[model samples]
Target: MSLSHEIMKNICGYSRAKYSTWFYYRPDHILFDAGEGVSLALRNMIYGIDHIFISHNHGDHIGGLPGLIKSRASSMGDITKPLSIYYPEKDSQILQFKEYLDVSIPKLPFVLTWKGLRPGDQISLNANRFVEAFASDHMGTLSLGYKIIEKRKRLKSEYKGLPQQELIACIKDLGREAIHEEYHKNLLVYSGDTMPLDVSIVQNAEVLLHDATFVLGSDREENTHATVEEACELAIKAQVACLALFHFSSRYSHQQVKDKIYEIITANNVEIPIHYIYPHFYPSDFKQIQIEN
Candidate 1:
């Protein structure tokens, strides 16, 4: 299987525009959003999440916080584990929701933290992995996109093409750091709910889960969401290894959604495998619909 396929196997999610959207990246124990039915969909797996990154304060994006928190506290799992939630700084709606949760669930068993983040802020996952926040255009309120980055080491340009023995000797004599340079690779980029992102933001990412709220360009009357064509174009321009479109509007049928995406991929000759989450009932299996061109 391709690396993208392997990565997708570990992720489970559900998205329906103006309704709900959530993704559980099992590898990192992170949830992107806590839309309605998230707790029910994940069931016992909800306790596995250690962190949640909220993109915006939209109801569809954050309606499940109460259930998720209560489930972690009272469900059939470890209730003492702490969970951290990160959101765009100064989001009033989210702050209000947090207050409500505090008032409603005063005696929580587990530690729950809510931290606001600005663009360029990062939360360390490990010594070499982190989640960084970036500004995104969605609503009047500040919204954010997230990128999961991993630090990797590569041989210095000057050491490239050197014989294996020579490289080994250089590493031995000058130390590994001296012979290599550190680079950041984007493991995943989540464009929560917004227009087509700038190519630079998602450049070379292994997987990009972008907003595809409209299948027909003419149907989009506002600039808040992206069309199917725009998402595909962004993926190609960014050279992302994999594209997974989500948050589709319910107006389009499953076949309509697939046809539009296929049209775009074929027109552009997009080589990366494209996947989509249709806007229907929130699926329990959460398998992404894959499209190849």
Candidate 2:
């Protein structure tokens, strides 16, 4: 195939204060976090996605489930592919979800799968893609983040001049599986909601969606959320290609949050481009702008 960037499609990640709703497209299908008004966004993005990933059981995280399931059923979606949900089987939240699925969406024409995730659990999604769920610092209930990645051989930039036919021949001679064993890279890491911690689990991910709720002491320790400084510390430590700061507290204005985060990360010599997810309450554009460097 010709060299082309994957069609990236993330419009919004936060509905209002402290809410997450995002749309991400991998090579296979679109993905999203369960949140209020997420169904409408998903419909606008792609026809019913086969896979849906939820971060936690907070109201903001799961409040959208009811509507989403109903909409799909009402729309007459023929979900031949099973909808797989990767979430931690914590408290009675699963029971609530089940009740919603049973009563609200009593006629689910699709198969649904659920699995209890723990630290070090790796979900090999496809031939060359994998998602790893690790322990997040967020408490109150079980919360998790995901790392999307390529588990195949790296393409050397030095081999650009070689024709594809030649490369195919070389691969055939050397055995494609043998070459795939070397040079794999992590592509993306998403921290649903968490305090600052070492993000080495997703080290070098091309994209990182991390929590940046507090900007200079916006919240108390009773509710732990990472400040801009802390978020940058984790990003700088992981050395990811890009950082998408999200889950902002209701306190800061859009400009105030960005300005505060940009200033601190810059001062600390954090060089990776930082992106922000605008809350729905903000009238500003949801377009996430990144730094030049």
Candidate 3:
């Protein structure tokens, strides 16, 4: 609900669906898909970022590359930290796209580190959170989804003044000697834009972000994408703690999609805590959402 922990600005949504962009900050500040002027928004707001992950090589996804490169060139001179980029590569599409950007923006002034995006790759940020990349289905281009895993550190507040090295040695010598014990860490999985697939990938996650582009009875295919009903089915199958639907089609209104999804799930007699990412909504318009730790 806060701006930093989980702020999803709908830079592009349910409007022409051409520029489908979103800046989601959960495990880290991630620029989902760079649409028109998205780089300008990031340059103005987001900070502490030296990496960029692209879901696909679509124009909407990589459109802002030139602008961002130019901006970086204009700002810092010869920055030590290179711009890290991750994108799926079935061929040399990612490389060619990057080369196009580089040649287009010759004055990039800084180093650019580009890497191939592979599925089942565990991505960790600092020591607090880790992100796992998975394959996603997008038209003719390669796409990927991300799962954010927040590792928990169990701190025993009662054993504050106790010895440090001795405690660890004692635990090694004596089993369960220490009072600290870490349990299952929290996880959040996001399916950028995909069709039906294995749900086991998100079994360890507490929250799931599903792509509910279309509704039921709409034209859906394995090669195409999922609808609202399809996303609900996947969420129900995964049985995750919570599910948030995103990436709706531009044809349907927000209210229409909301009502249709509710009706279909209810008709099927399945229930779960479902949330819609309504970026246009705020505390003044919609009631304050319950904050969870």
TM-score of 1: 0.96
Candidate 3: lDDT of 233? Answer: 75
Candidate 2 has a TM-score of 0.80
Tens-place lDDT per residue, model 1, 94-180, is: 999999999998899988999999999999998999999998889656999999999999988999999999988998999888988
Candidate 1 lDDT for residue 159: 96
TM-score, every prediction: 0.96, 0.80, 0.73
Q: Candidate 2 lDDT, tens digit per residue, 1-293?
A: 21111222333345454555554554545364677777766563333466666677777777777777666655645544456767765646866776667775665766766676776677777888777777777776777777776765655665456788987986889766544445557676777777875766767777777777787774656556777777787778888777777777767787888788768766787766677766744321344445557
Over 13-43, each residue of candidate 3 has an lDDT whose tens digit, in order, gives: 2111455454445236555555556556555
Best by TM-score: 1
State candidate 3's TM-score. Answer: 0.73
Better of 1 and 3 by TM-score: 1
Number of clashes recorded per candidate: 0, 1, 0
Where in model 3 is the C-alpha error above 4 Å?
1-16, 75-81, 152-186, 268-272, 277-293
| Per-residue error (Å), model 1, residue 238 | 0.8
